[model samples]
Target: MTARRPTAIDIVEVGPRDGLQNDSRHLSTEAKVEMIAKLAGAGLRRIEAASFVNPKRVPQMADAEAVLARVVDLPGVSVSGLVLNGRGFERALAAGLREISFVAVATDTMAARNQGTTARGLVETWAGIAKRAEAEGLFRSVTIAVAFGCPFEGEVPLARVIEIARALAESGADEISLADTIGVATPLAVEERFAALSEAVPGLPMRAHFHNTRNTGYANADAALRSGVTVLDASLGGLGGCPFAPGATGNIATEDLVSMLERDRVATGVSLELLRDATLWLEGEMGRRLPAHGAHVSPWPRVLAA
Candidate 1:
């Protein structure tokens, strides 16, 4: 018997924030705003517009407030920001962002390198942020990076991943995301982990964030879908990588994912042609070819007269 398929899926576009954060090129606030608007126009409902982190650390996100200020008016678009601590959360709140993503690494070493704290310490910090968000009626999603394997510490234990996920759930995270920070996860691993997480968390929605580093990103996405994950994170033009993880690559490309999903009859509410066009525009702005496959290929082929 064939497994039941979901009628639709939620795709959270992370281009403006996660996509550009590690880039050497700095996009002006205007460029960022324009990119976000184009994404919204292409029917992406949830977009991660900015990251309220220290500019000294991730200079690409230095214009978070300015970008948010300009893109907050897009109709039907839910703009969100990434906040690692109470300070970042406060700044997002001040910027009128109603949704926020909080991240915690799976291993202590990764946590220390990314957030200047241990995994447990970052959980504690997120607890306070979650509490405040709950009180303020804001949406909170906690992403556990390196859920499959850590760059510093290879093959993070499943028990450890579950433990950290439980802590974040207890802290009142509305959604939980499992991140393949260095793109080391296989389909079997994604299936097992997400199935275990579903059993462990029971009711909370799950999201998958995969990188195409070793070319397994789309496979992992398929696994997540089969495991009942409702939300997925992708970047426009496949434009993201972890600065702390050596050799890590970009997230699965939004247009590429959309093309695959739509072909499979999964509704993403995103227009593939428009998304591809956006990637082309982004390529022009960056003056380089992006890593997204859909950006380089057409969804439909033209027919020649026989």
Candidate 2:
């Protein structure tokens, strides 16, 4: 029997935050706002538009408040912020963002290197953030970074991921996201872990965040869909990486992912042509040819808007 696939999906654009955090260049606040506006114009409804981390740690996101102030009014679009600690979460709350994504790593070494905490400590942090967001009636999501594998700690056990997810689910996360931080996951692994998470934490929604660092990100996305995950994350122009993860590459490009999904009759509600156009604009602004192939190629004929 054929497996059921989601006819439609939500692709949360992480371009403004995760996409730029690792870049050598820091885009002006105006440019960042323009990027978010252009992404929303292309039908990206859910966008991770800013990160509220220390400027010294991730300077590219230093203008988090300024960027949010400008883009929060985009009609019919949801603007969110990423936070790694209580202070960042508090800043997001003060900024009045309705949604926030909190990240927790899978292992101690990655946690220390990424944020100078233990994985368990991050989980504790998430519980509190979730509680505060709930009290504030804000949408809260927790991403399990390096769920597939960690550069510092070769392989992260599946049990550990399930444990972390269980804690988040119990702690009031509106959504649970799994990140392939360095992109070491295969399709099989993606399917297995998502299935296991579903079984362990029944009924909670799942989101997938894949990096194209190993060229397996798209395949992992397919597996996540087949495993009943409808929400996925991508960076515009395929331009993002975790600064904590060495040798990691950009994310699965939004245009490329949209093109692939549209071909399979999966509705992402994104305009492929416009996405391609956006990719070109981004490349020109950043002054580099992104790893994504969508801008270099033509969208499938049938998927174009009239």
Alpha-carbon shift of residue 204 in model 1 (angstroms): 0.8
Q: What is the C-alpha lDDT of each candidate?
A: 0.89, 0.89
Report residue 65 deviation for candidate 1 (angstroms). Answer: 0.5
Q: What is the lDDT of residue 271 in candidate 1?
A: 90
Model 2, C-alpha of 270: deviation from truth (Å): 0.9
Cα lDDT, model 2, residue 192 = 89
Candidate 1 on 1-306: residue-level lDDT in tens? 545557799999998888898777778788898899999999999999988889898888888888898887789998999888889998988999888899888999988877889999999999889989999988899999899998799989999999999988998989999999888999999989998999889999999999898999998898899888999999999997777655667889999898888878899999988898999999888788888988786456545559
In model 1, the Cα lDDT at residue 282 comes to 95
What is the C-alpha lDDT profile of model 2 across 1-306, one tens digit per residue?
646779999999998888998888778998898899899999999999988888887788888899999988788888899889999999998888988899988999999987999999998998888888999999888899999998889999999999999987889888898899888899999988999999988988899999998889898888899998989999999998767566678888999889889889899999988888888989989998988898897545746666
Name the TM-score of candidate 1. Answer: 0.96
Native-to-model Cα distance after best TM-score fit, residue 32 in candidate 1, in Å: 0.6
- Which portions of model 1 miss their true places by more than 4 Å? 245-248, 301-306
**Where does candidate 2 have its weakest 10-residue lDDT segment?**
297-306
